[model samples]
Target: MSKDVWVIIEHQDGAPKKISLELLGRARELAETLGGTVVAFVPGAGVSNVAESLGSRGADIVYAADHALLQPYTADAYAQAVSQALQAEQPTLVLVGSTAQGRDYAPRVAARLGAGIVTDCASLEVADGHLVATRPMYTRKTIGTVVFSSGGIRIAVVLPAVYSVPPAEAGRRAEIRAFQVALDSKGVRTQVREVRAIQRETVPLTEADVIVSGGRGLKGPENFALLDALAKALGAAVGSSRPPVDSGWVSHDYEIGQTGKTVSPQVYLACGISGAPQHLAGMSGAKYIVAINKDSNAPIFQLADLGIVGDLFEIVPKLTEAIRQAKGRA
Candidate 1:
C-alpha cells in the first residue's frame, strides 16, 4: 500500500461534517509522520465546491466524486463507489468518522477490499510504522488496543470529539482530482424519498459540546421543558436516559446510553439520572460530568465530577436563570 492516508469525507448542508474535519486533522498528523500526502475523498452530487473547501483544511489532494445517485446517501452506492476506489488506489491507511453513515458504509468498503478495520476508535497513533488504535470495550469498563497484520490497507472508524479540529489555513489549496465511479442507477435499491425532521431548538445530541439530560425523575413528558430551558441557557443539547425514552417521555433520538447514542461532549449535565451501567457506557467519555439527583447514593454521583444532592425540579430553573444572568453580564 502507498504511504498516503485517505479520509472519506462526510458532508451535510454541502459542507464537511465536524467528524469529517476531525478525521482530516488526524489524517494530517498521520500523513506527516509517514511522509505521505493527506488525501480527502469527497463523494456526493455537485460536491466540487466541498472538495475545494477542504483544500485549506490540511488536504494535499482532494478527490471530487460527483454523481446524481450519490445524493441522499445510500449505503449501497457509497460502499460500492468507495470500495472500488480503495481497491484501485490502495492507500496505506483510511480514516472514516463513526457517524451513522460512516459506520454503515465503512465496513462494506473494508469487506469488499479485504482490509482490516477497527471501529469506534477513541485513540490512534502510529508506532513502528504500524497504526495502533484504541477503543472502549465491555461498556467502556476497559480499553482495548488493536494492531493489524502487515501488508494491506487499514481502516479506522473514529469516535467524534476525541480529537480537536485543526484550524483551516486561508489561501491554501490542494490539487483537485476528478474521481468517477461506475454504477447502475436502476439497480440502486435504497432511495431516500423525503426527510422528516424532529423540531427541536437545541443542537444535535452527538455534536453538542454540552448536553443536559434527564431520566425517570423527569416524571412526565412535560418536565422536559426544564431541561430545554437549561440547555438553551447553556447553549447545549437536550438528551435523556433510557428510562425516560422507554416511558415515552422523549423520542429515542434523545436517548444517551448503550442502547442509544454514544456521546463524548465537553460537558454533560445529568439531571435525575441514576447512572445505570448501560447509560454510562455511552457518556463516560465526557470531559466533565455533573449529576443532580435527590438520591445522594445514586450511581451517577460516583462518576460525576460534581454531584448535587437536591430535587431537580427546584435546581433546574435556578441553574438556568443563573447561567442566563452570567451570560447577560458577560
Candidate 2:
C-alpha cells in the first residue's frame, strides 16, 4: 500500500479554500496513523502563490499544475490534470471536497484511473488497516459505514463543513513542484461562457457554526422577526423551513431541508419546526439540536437534543435576554 495521502487543493487567490483546509486536517490525521506523509495537489491557472499556506496546514509537498485553460472549472480539464497526478504520485488515499466543481470532476478522475470512489463521506478512520468511512443512510434514519472493496487506492469526495478547518502552523514549509497536464481534443469538450458570482447578504448556513431555523408554526412571515433577536443574541445565522419561503415571507436562500441547503452546525436551533423527514435530512448532522415549539407531541421532539415545550413568543425573547445578560452584552 502506498503510504502517501493526497488532497486536491482548490482556491482562487493565495489562500486555500475552506474545504481544502478541512480535508487537509483529516489527511494529516490519517497520514500520522499510517506513518505516511500528506501531499497537496493543486491544479488550476496560476496557483503557485497558494502553496505555502497549504504546507502550513499539514501538506508535506505541494504539487501544482498551473495552465492557462484551467481557469474556470471544466471537468475534462481538471480530471485530466488529477489523473496525471495520480499516475505520478500513486498516493494511497485521495480526498476531494464535494463542492459543485468537485462533484462534477471527481467521478471523471476516478473513471480515468478505474478507481472506486465514495461521495459525501462524513467521517473516516483507520480500522483493521483499512480506511472506514461513516455516513448517513435511509435519509439519516441510520448510519452506514463504507470501505473500498476494489481496495487499492481510494478516492473520496468529502462533504463541506463535515470536518473542521485545520489550524495553520506558521513556520511549516513544503517543497513545491509542478505537474503538467496535456489536453487533447477529447479533454476540451466544453467551453465555459461566463461565471457569475452571487453575493447574498445572509450568512451561508453551510458555514455557520450556529443556525436558528423557523418553520410554519412561527405563524407567518412577519412573526419570524421574533427570531432575529435570538439569532443576534447567539451570534447565529437565520434559516427557515420551506413554508416561509413558499409563502414568500423569506427568501428561498434561507430555506433548510432536502430541497434547500443541507447544514451541519455545532448548534441547530429548530424553532417551531415539525421535523419532517425532509427537514431532518438537512440538519440531522448537527452536533446539538434544540427544538422550541408549543406542541410537546411535535415530531421535532423526537430528534432534538433538548426540547422546549412553550410558545416561542414567550420562550424566545426570554432566552435571548438570558443569553445577552449571561454574555454581559447588556
Candidate 3:
C-alpha cells in the first residue's frame, strides 16, 4: 500500500466544513511522520471550486470526484464512490470527520474495503511504524489505545475540534486531478429531491464554542426559558440531558448525551444535570465544565471545574443578568 494519508473532505454551502479543515491539519502531521504526502479527496457535484484551495491548508494532492450522482449527499452513492476510489489507490490511511454525514457513510466504505476502522478518535499518532488512536469506550468509562494490524488500509473517523486548524501557507500549490467513479444508475439507492433546513437561533451543538445545558432539575418545559435566557447572555447553544428530552421539555435537537449529540465545546455549563455516565460520555471533552445543582453531592460536581450548590431556579437568572451586564460593559 502507498504511504499516503487521504482525507475525505465534507463541505456545506459550497465551502469545506471546519471539521474537514481540521482533518486536513491532522493529516498533514500524520503524513510527515509516515513519510508520505497528504492527499485530499473532494467528492461532490461540481466540487473543483471546493477542492482548489485545499493545497494551502495542507494537501499535497487533491482528487476532485465530480459526478451528478454525487449531489445531495446520499449515503449509498458516497459509500460506493469513496469505496471504489480507495480500492483503486489503496492509500495507507483514510481519515473522515465523525459528523452525522461521516458516521452515516464511513462504516459502509470500511465494510466495502474490509478494512479496520476506529470511530470517534480523540487523538491519533504514529507509534512503532503503525497508526495508534486513543478512543473513549464503554460510555467513556475508560480510554483504549488502538493499533492497526499490518497489511491492510486503516480508516479513522475523528471527532471535531480535537486539533487546531493550521494557518494556510500562501503560494503553496497542489496537483489537482480529476477523478471519475464509474457509477451505475442501479447502484444509487436513495434520492434526495428536497432539503428543508430548520431555523436555529444558536449554532449547532458540535460547532458551538460554549454550551448551556439543562437536565431533570429543570422541572418542566416552561423552565427552559430560564436556560434560554442564560444561553443568550452567554452566547452559547442550548442543550439538555436525556431527562428534559424524555419529559418533552425540548426537542431531540437540544439533547446532549450518549443517545444525543457529542460536543467538545470550550465551555460546558451544565445546570441541574446529575451527570449520568451516558451524559458525561458526550460532553466530557469540553475544555471547562461548570455545574449548578441544589445537591452539593450531585455527580456532576465531581466532573465540574466550578460547582455551584444552589437552586438553579434562583441561580440561573442571577447569573444571566450578571453576564448580560458584563457584556454591556465590554
- Could you report the Cα RMSD, in angstroms, for every candidate shown? 1.3, 2.4, 1.7
Candidate 3, residues 84-122, lDDT tens digits: the string is 889999999999999989999999999999999999999
Give the lDDT ranking, best first: 3, 1, 2
Residues 16-83 of candidate 1: C-alpha lDDT, one tens digit per residue: 98888888999999999988899999989999878989988999999988888899899988988888
lDDT of each: 0.91, 0.86, 0.92
Q: Which scores greater on TM-score, model 1 or model 2?
A: 1
Encode model 2's per-residue lDDT on 1-330: one tens digit a residue: 578999999886577788899999999999999888999998888788887668889899988888877777788888888888887778889999877688889999888898889877888888888788887777788888998777666899887789998678988998898777776646679999998764654466777899999998888888878888888888899999999899998888888877888788999999989999989978888999999999899999998999999998899989988999999955
Q: Give the TM-score of candidate 2.
A: 0.90
Q: What is the lDDT of residue 292 in candidate 3?
A: 95
Residue 127 in candidate 1, Cα distance off native in Å: 1.6
Off by over 4 Å in 1: none
Q: Counting only residues 3 or more apart in sequence or on different chains, how many pairs clash (N, Cα, C under 3 Å) in candidate 3?
A: 0
The per-residue C-alpha lDDT of model 3 at residue 213 equals 96
